[model samples]
Target chain A: MSNTTHPDTSRSSDESAHAEVTVPRSPELEVEQEAALRLWVILSRAHAAIASHAHADVARSGLTLAEFAILEVLYHRGPMLLGEVQRRILVSSGGITFLVDRLTAKGLVERRNCDKDRRARYAALTPPGEALVAELFPAHADAITQAMRGLAADDQQVVAEMLRSLGLHAAAKPLP
Target chain B: MSNTTHPDTSRSSDESAHAEVTVPRSPELEVEQEAALRLWVILSRAHAAIASHAHADVARSGLTLAEFAILEVLYHRGPMLLGEVQRRILVSSGGITFLVDRLTAKGLVERRNCDKDRRARYAALTPPGEALVAELFPAHADAITQAMRGLAADDQQVVAEMLRSLGLHAAAKPLP
Candidate 1:
C-alpha cells in the first residue's frame, strides 16, 4: 500500500554513507523480499476469509470454534491425551484445560486416566459429543467446501501442497 | 488423532434407516468434503506457523501485532479513517479505538478531524512512528522472507494467486 521504497528511504546522510559501503544492493534479495511480503498478505487474507465463514457455521451449531475443533478432532481421532489434543488444536495448555472443563460440564467430553500411564489422562468424546459431531460435521464440511469452491480441485490440491510445505518449513525453524 | 470413522459408527439402527433414505451417498460430494477438510487443516496450520513467528518479531520491536499492523497500514497509505483501519486489520471497533488510544498516548499516532466532514476523523502516524517503522520494517520484512523461504519463487507466486482467488470468493459471499 505504501509506495515508498524501504530500507533505502528517509536515511540520514551519515547512515547513508555507512550503508553505501556496508549494504550491497542485491536485486535478487529485493525481489525475494517483495514476494514474501505479498505472499504473507495474500495468505493472511485468504485464511481470514475461510476462518470467518467456518466460524459462523460453527456458531450456528451452538459451539465455539474451539469447541467444534476439539469435538471434530476427537470424533475423527478417537480418544487422545490431553496434551495431544492441545497440540492438535493449537490451543494453549490452560485454554485447553478450560475448554475441556466446559465440555465436561456439558456432558460432551470425558477425561479418563490412561491405562498404562497412571499420571496421564485422555480426553474422549461422550455419546452426546459423538452425536453432536455427527450432526454438525456435514455442515462444517459444507462451509469449507463453499469457501473453497472458487478453486478447481486441482488448484485446491496444489495450494494445499504448497501451504503444507510452507507450514512445515516455518514450524521447523525457530523464530529469529 | 482419532482414527474413528464418523457419523456412521454412533447412529442408532432406526436412525441409520432414516438416514439411508434422507442422506444420499454421492462419491463426488464425499471427495469434495474430504478435500475441503484437508484444505482447512493445511491452511490453518500454515497460518498458525507464520503468525507465531511474525508475532514474535513484532513483539521484539515493542509493538503488539495489531499495533504494528495499524502503523504499517498508516505508514503506507497515509492517514485513514478509524473504520477503514478497523476493516483492514480485522479488529473490532472497540479494539481499534483502544489501539489508537495506546498509540496516541505513546506519541506515535494522532487523530485529526477532517475539514470537509466534521464527523470523520483520521488516524495518521507521527514522525516518531514513521521513524520506528522505517527502522523496524526491514526486520519485519526479513522475518516474512525467512518464514516463506521454503517455497521457490514460482511456488510462492502460484500460491499467492490461488489464495487471492479463494479470498476474493469467500469475501464476496454472504455469511450463511
Candidate 2:
C-alpha cells in the first residue's frame, strides 16, 4: 500500500504512474486493483440510495439539500463561520456566498460581522429558522435512521469505524 | 429494524413517521439516529477523497469522469445498452443521450442497431476507444489501488462486503 511497494512502476506518489514496461503484473496486484475498483462502485451505490431517501425528507421541508445541511450544522453547533459551513458540507451545491445569499433571502438565516476579526463573518439561523429546524430536526434524523435500517446495528457500527479511517487517510496529501 | 418495532411514530413503511404523541424516543432510538448521521458524513468524505484520485487519473486521459465511466464499463463489460450504462453508473453527469453524443463526436464510441430488436441500440467502443482503454486500464486500476491504499487489503474486502449488503437493502422498495 505504500509507495515503497511499487517504487519502480510508480515514480510519484501524488501522480498515477503511467504504464511502466517493467511493472510486474502480479496476480496479487490484479486482485488488489479489482478489489479497490469494486469497492468504489459499491460505495457509490450505497451513498446514492441513502442520499435519495435523505434528500426526499429534506425536500418536504422546502429546503434544498445544501441549505438543510447548513441549517443542521448551525442547529447542532450554534453560529459558525461561513467557510466552516462550506467545509462541513461534502457537496456544496454552489459557492458558499450563493447558498448563504439564498438562505438570507429566505429569511431563514442571517449574517453577522465578527468583532474580533474584521475579515471574518458568521452565519446564524434566525429565530424562525431555529424554531423551524427544532421542529423538523428530529423527523429529519428519523428519515436517515429509516434509510439506513437495512443494516443491523452492529453492522452500522463496523461500517462507521471503517469509513472514518478510510476518509482520514484519503484526505491526507502524499508527502511531496 | 422492522416496522413492527415503531408502528406508532412511523406509520408508512416507505415514509418517515412523524412525531407521534405517544411514541417513546428511547435512548436506543437516539443512539441509532446519531450513528446513521455520522456514518453518512464519514461515507461522503471517503467517497469524495477516493473519487478525487480516480478522477485525476481519468482527467489525464482527456476524458471527463462520466465519459470515462461509460468507456470503462464498455471496456470491462463489453458493449451494453445505453440505458444499462446509465444505470450502472451511480452518478450520471447528464442525460445518457448527451453523454453518448459527446463520446460519438470524439469517435471513441459508435452506436449499432441491436440485431435482436430494432428499437434497442448498443454502444460499442470503436477501435480507437478499445485501444485507448486497453492502454490506460492498467494504470487506471493502479490509481484506484493507490487511492485505496489507506486501508489494509483485508479491510477493503470487509468494506466491499458490507457495502454490498447495505446497497442492496437500500435499493429495495419499502412495502407500502
Best by TM-score: 1
Q: After superposition, how far is residue A5 of candidate 2 from its true place, in Å?
A: 31
Error of 1 at B160 (Å): 0.4
Q: For model 2, how does the per-residue alpha-carbon lDDT over A1-176 read when each residue is reduced to its tens digit?
A: 00000001211233432233446678888778767877877777777677666677777878876788777777666787887777776544346778789989999999999998888789999988887887887788787788788787778889979987876776674521
lDDT for each of the candidates? 0.77, 0.70
Instruction: Encode model 2's per-residue lDDT on B43-78: one tens digit a residue.
Output: 767777776676677778788767787787776667
Instruction: Report lDDT (Cα) of residue B58, candidate 2.
Output: 79
DockQ of each: 0.34, 0.25
Q: For model 1, how does the per-residue alpha-carbon lDDT over A1-176 read when each residue is reduced to its tens digit?
A: 10101111222234331233235558898778777878887787787788778877887977777888889878776788998878777788787888899999999999999999998899999999988988988778888899888787778888999999998898788877
Global lDDT of model 2: 0.70
Flag clash pairs in model 2: none
